[model samples]
Target: MKHALVFVASPDDKPAYREALLMLGRVALSRKLPPPDVLSGWESAQWIYDSVDGELRQEAAAAVAELPVDWALTPVAGRKKKLLVADMDSTIINVECLDELADFAGIKAEIAAITERAMRGDLEFEPALRERVAKLKGLATEALQKTYDERVRLNPGAATLVKTMAANGARCVLVSGGFTFFTERVAEAAGFHASRANTLLEDATALTGLVQEPILGRAAKLDALRSEARALGVSEQDALAIGDGANDLDMIKAAGFGIAYHAKPLVAAEADAKIDHMSLEAALFFQGYRRGEFVS
Candidate 1:
């Protein structure tokens, strides 16, 4: 079967050496991919290889860690998906927004512990989220805006991934278990076509310690994926989903190409593809796109 191996270096820590690509070319049944068609170079590359068999591709991908880069292995056909459904916290953004909110409430360690457990699948998502939010009850409403301004920054290559995908006519949606307040900002900044998230209820000037009912958890994420795919006149297999925590598992598993991006251990173990050492643009390479083709 025809396969492709995408190699990605850490965006900020890219090695200064040159032999990494040379060594990669020595693998049997593989040919070097040309330099990025739209740019002078790229931090990641793809090799459209004629694998001797199915397992050979897996074996090659597994062994790529020995090199100075991270990698993903996927089939050559339908590599570029038509839709992108992604998680916001710890996936599109560098910090978990709720945890940052916890910091403003002076309960950082306590709330972050629950967040860690919830993300690792050690705790039920709904209950954990409630517990965390409850602790922030009575906190000033402006804290949300403050957290967004001071702490919420996009993860490396996040914009490049969303914009490039959108430019290729793919629809991008930010479906997060976080909140609408942050998702609205992130989706706009990242250039996603739509956004959906739970709403954090607020009183006159403070949080009400409650989220609107029917909280958007794991199941909701899956629903959003299906609904978006249907609206786009595509099957679930035509979509790509990426996330970094337990709440994202269902949709991640349901998509044609699901990736765990710098994910928790449980997610990484179950996702179709895992990106542990690269930026969001690695997802683009996984879809057979070159850096030059990126919109921004």
Candidate 2:
């Protein structure tokens, strides 16, 4: 029997899902869909939310090889895809928290320069974080909430992605190159199971303008991936890691599937899959989902 990616999605997202399905279908049409239950080179079939009989899928693809057709089906939610890890800054929200904070401090130009370097893998992540955080020492801690209220917006499809993934017995982990203040907030807002990030200095109620010593750098992100995967009892292949910067590379590499979400050039090129010019919903495609079994 042959093995192929079974792409399924939900009806709510059907328009995009349908588009993705037809794309996969085109591939199946090309090779006449490999014979299922018979392992061979060009063997794969794209199916909607059906208990895809390997043999059946191959038959269908080969049966319709000359003509491409759209398979309309909806996903059955809570089917369970576990262990989703995401980066908080640009991936979860529309902007990087530190960059916004820096802008608030009137040092936007300087901090943005450093951020670009860090995101592109040019400069080390920790040092860049430290330098940026140090510039905000005098801002009131209350500014954090105000910023959240003003600009800490979640990305499109973020709520649906996290909620659906979590409902499927998946353990969600938020790992970021940013600080804990922001990571923690994101974790709570998004219903993530756990989160890890560097700590920032807050003396009582005011910003200390510094990250804690021994910052959680790139290696730390990797550790979070491994630990969460182990805890979730899923092999590395079942893991889904998402991020958008250089610091997230190691962690992304450590997971079964690494996604570069609107990332810097370096990260987008290095990740297992790239979510370019698209929302997090694009990540669902790499999972090879169809609309029949994954939507609630």
Candidate 3:
């Protein structure tokens, strides 16, 4: 039997698994008697249905194509992901770093505008990152931790996703364009195996207003994937990546399964799977996991 993964994207609507299975069956039967083996997974509000059928693989592949913002079709074994690397801002959590920092700087509206351009692929993320960080100059560095306490919020199902992945023997790595200070705490709370992000420099109990050079951008986010893959004894094909900005392209392209979660148009167009309509748990489908079987 050959495998097929069907993902539905519509962040605003969640479909019932029973109903989705029924509809999928109708779609498959409409092609003739190519009955198949199926595995299922879900997140946010959508369900992913995987079917194995040698006779109808081609037709099934065509049927599910372009039905959503992002979907992945692969041989069942080919789609299984052994590692998951996720972005923190607007991903594992709902807030963007620079936008929140702007709030602290009393220029929330202005910085948020810059952030919008950057996330939408309109502005370069590295330069925008620098400009935003520069604005934070002179703010007490302790504010970083305060931001962690007041603004760093986890998205729905984020904890479930990480804990579930880890329990299943998959390594969960939290990579971010934000900062290591927050990434560290997020890793602990989410039960992540490890994490990487830009370091915010501080001295004398105040903001240094500087990020250590060689910041982690999209390129660096990609490097975290490679680094984690090696640590986990896997190849690029053994990895999965999820993020919501232009900077995530590198890791997404290199991974076995790249997911765009509530992403901008640019990211959704290119990733292996997209899950804007649901929670982070939706990623389990690429790993061949079913909702009932989810560890958490």
TM-score winner: 1
lDDT by candidate, in order shown: 0.84, 0.67, 0.73
- Candidates ranked by TM-score, best first? 1, 3, 2
Give the TM-scores of the predictions, in the order they appear: 0.91, 0.76, 0.83
Question: Candidate 3's residue-wise lDDT over 35-66, tens digit each?
Answer: 43444333212222344445444454354443
Model 3 lDDT, full chain set: 0.73
Candidate 1: where are CA atoms >4 Å away?
Answer: 10-23, 29-42, 50-52
The local lDDT score (0 to 100) that residue 240 gets in candidate 2 is 78
172-290: candidate 2 lDDT, tens digit per residue: 88887777877888888877888888887898888988787778878888888888878767776677788898988987887767778878888876676565544565455435443
Mark the 10 consecutive residues where model 2 has the least summed lDDT.
Answer: 36-45
> What lDDT tens digits, residue by residue, belong to model 1 across residues 1-296?
67776666654544511333544545542444444222115366556765546565566565564665666677777889999999999899999999999899899999999999999999999989898999999999999999999999999889999999999999999998899999999999999999999999999999999999889999999999999999999999999999999999999999999999989989988888888867788888788887668788
RMSD in angstroms between candidate 2 and the native structure over all alpha carbons: 7.7
* Top-scoring candidate (lDDT): 1
Write the candidate numbers in order of decreasing lDDT. Answer: 1, 3, 2
Q: Candidate 2 has what TM-score?
A: 0.76
Alpha-carbon RMSD to native, per candidate:
2.7, 7.7, 4.2
Whole-structure CA lDDT of model 2: 0.67
